[model samples]
Target: MMTRRGVQWISSAADDPEECREHWALDPRSPHALPAGRYFDVVAVGQRVGLETFDQLQRHGMPLGPVMADRASEQVGFFLPTWAKSPFDRMVRQETADRAPEYRYLGENSVVVVPGPMPLAGDRYIWLRAPMRRPEASLPRIAALAAMFVAASSVVARADRYGREQSAASVDGGATHAH
Candidate 1:
């Protein structure tokens, strides 16, 4: 879907992965634009989604998927405050432990990949050009990472549900939307 911001986004339920790539590649407004086969580290959606909100999204039918090293678009990743010693962090750690042995991270709470397909495809190596030693520099990177995760999760959930609906419909004479 092309947003008002001029960003062309592909729903996880998109019919053609190749076509999505083609559209992304052709869009000059796309910051992560690349030719076929290449992928951006994250899909910028220009907003933030809280964890609770993400849960609500799932309740509404967008289910996040597991993360896979070989396929970034198969899962979503996130970043949290390393110093955020809360119950949320503990839950996050437990989930992180479930990730594949070759999981990626930044600092302790810096980067975390939740299980779900990201909108982009590539290895999960986040690099910030800003000076990490400066406290203020961490702000933008953190915000960007968080937004990427939320946006990606939205795509994954929608796509996953769409795929399932298509499959179910094909199997039977009609399809029922899962809420």
Candidate 2:
């Protein structure tokens, strides 16, 4: 449970909490575009993979900062500490060479749309995990995320390989029957 102040700090562009509240009052359903690489960086992954990783994180009792989901885009964004941007980027590049899951690391010069503090009806962006007031208090480290991504990717890759093999076998069986 994040405090209102915490929500304001993370979701609002305004420095003042009161101003943030006023902005929210104007249109609670509307999302706000907050610049990345300032307070935190965003790592976005496919909704399916992200949800799987999120569940694993919870089961392992790992720290999770702030996570937002874009229903329309089918992506989940995990907020990391600003310092993690560079290292995470490097890791992603390396991992991608070996067929990593599709993801985007939004750091400096990137803008992310943050949902309103409270979950309102008809909001496209929703928070899976709210930010803590301390910012880093609940944030997971880059190493942890990297490991989870690798694990998830392996599972997906194996599933894909299995599916392909099954299809090939089915085709071969059908051809044999025809003969």
Q: Which stretches of candidate 2 lie over 4 Å from their true place?
A: 12-19, 90-100, 120-122, 137-140, 167-179
In the range 76-101, model 1's lDDT, one tens digit per residue, is 23323343224333433443424311
Q: Where in model 1 is the C-alpha error above 4 Å?
A: 1-136, 174-179
Error of 2 at 52 (Å): 1.1
TM-score for candidate 2, please give it: 0.78
Please state the error at residue 171 of candidate 1 in Å. Answer: 0.5
The deviation in Å at residue 127 for candidate 1 is 9.0
Give the 10-residue window scoring lowest on summed lDDT in candidate 1. 125-134
User: Candidate 2's residue-wise lDDT over 25-101, tens digit each?
Assistant: 78665677778887778889988778877777777877667788888998889888878866776776565656556
- Candidate 2 has an lDDT of 0.73
Q: Residue 116 lDDT in model 2?
A: 72
Local distance difference test, per candidate?
A: 0.33, 0.73
